[model samples]
Target: MKFLLTSGGVTNPSIRSALDGLLDKPVDQCTALCIPTGMYGHPWVGPGVKAWEFVAGKEEGNPMVGLGWRSMGLLELTALPSLPAEGWQPAVRDADVLLFSGGDAVYLSHWVRESGFADLLPELTDTVWLGMSAGSMVTTPRIGQEFVGWQPPGGGDDSTLGLVDFSIFPHLDHPALPTNTLAAAETWATGLGGPAYAIDDDTAIVVTDGGVEVVSEGTWKALAM
Candidate 1:
């Protein structure tokens, strides 16, 4: 399996290059499936419009387009609770990459389990998994509470998909994401029971099979409990 896990989506030249390397082909030849289910946690409303309508209509301006991938398609996994698997499985199977947006890790993790996509991942060995923030967090065994003050609804399990063994603490030391500081990351790591990575917006952790590489134009650190 391959992954390009970022704090923010392709925010810098090094990250873009890393993604290009993961693609291995020309950017225009690659197809992507954008899963925006994570956004469900951060609902917003606009004048004369419902929150869902506002969010549903705003699929444009995704960073994946700027990175030069071709034919990006949107798939809202949160809405698949009632839909047949046939409706979404083919899009996922055919896509060259699965791009996940950032939001609530707990919320996204629940949808990932409910939508059956977590079970399907083992078969998608060739598809590159691209994640940002919460998207990145869900690939780990657990989402640390220090990273996001929110917990799973109803005091449910905080476990994630565990596609990757270690947790990722994104946006480290970022002024905009004040809670995601290096100090907090260190505190979180102490109880993680495994390894963790603190990556800034300009950095990404690229994993191919069992190998891991940190590609960045900014700062990052690896931690162990």
Candidate 2:
């Protein structure tokens, strides 16, 4: 699968162009499946109006589902286990992209495993995994304890899917999130024991065919492990 991982969802023209390249078609021609499961794991974002806004593509800071796609659908991970894989797997295979929203990576990763979605990823070769914030973070090896919030059932480590080789510290230098400064990201990276990136809202990390590239129109840094 190809990846267009971002701190913010297609927040700038550069990132949007990257998305277009990944899709190999216009945004209006591709189909998308929006996964809003991660928002529920976040205390401040889900099971309420925030969740509704995200699904409706009206969330103030996030610009994902609202993008013009041929068709847009929701894939709530929590409901997948109750249904048969045959019922849902086809939809996943048919979609051009999977849009993941920002929230708690740990919770999102848990459901990604529990819901059997992680198992499906290996087969979706042509699909793009478009991730925002925690959505992007979940693709890495670990999110670090600083980003941990909603713990998994019976507990687990800070580890994620490790789809990529490194870690990500998102939302760097945002005025509203003072703790998300570059210095904090650097401090967070030291304990990760692997390569990591600290990226602002205008940045994205693209991974296609095992090649990684940073697509940014804003500040970013690759912290050494």
Best by lDDT: 2
Candidate 1 lDDT over 8-88, as tens digits, reads 778777888888888857778998877777766644311223323323434332265345567778787877778899998
Q: What TM-score does each of the candidates earn?
A: 0.87, 0.98
Query: What lDDT is reached at residue 39 by model 1?
Result: 61
Runs with alpha carbons beyond 4 Å of true place in candidate 1? 43-62, 148-154
- Regions of model 2 farther than 4 Å from truth: none
lDDT of 1 at 139: 90
lDDT of 1 at 135: 80
Tens digits of per-residue lDDT for model 2 on 73-158? 89999999999999898999999999999889999999999999999899989999999999999999999999999877688889
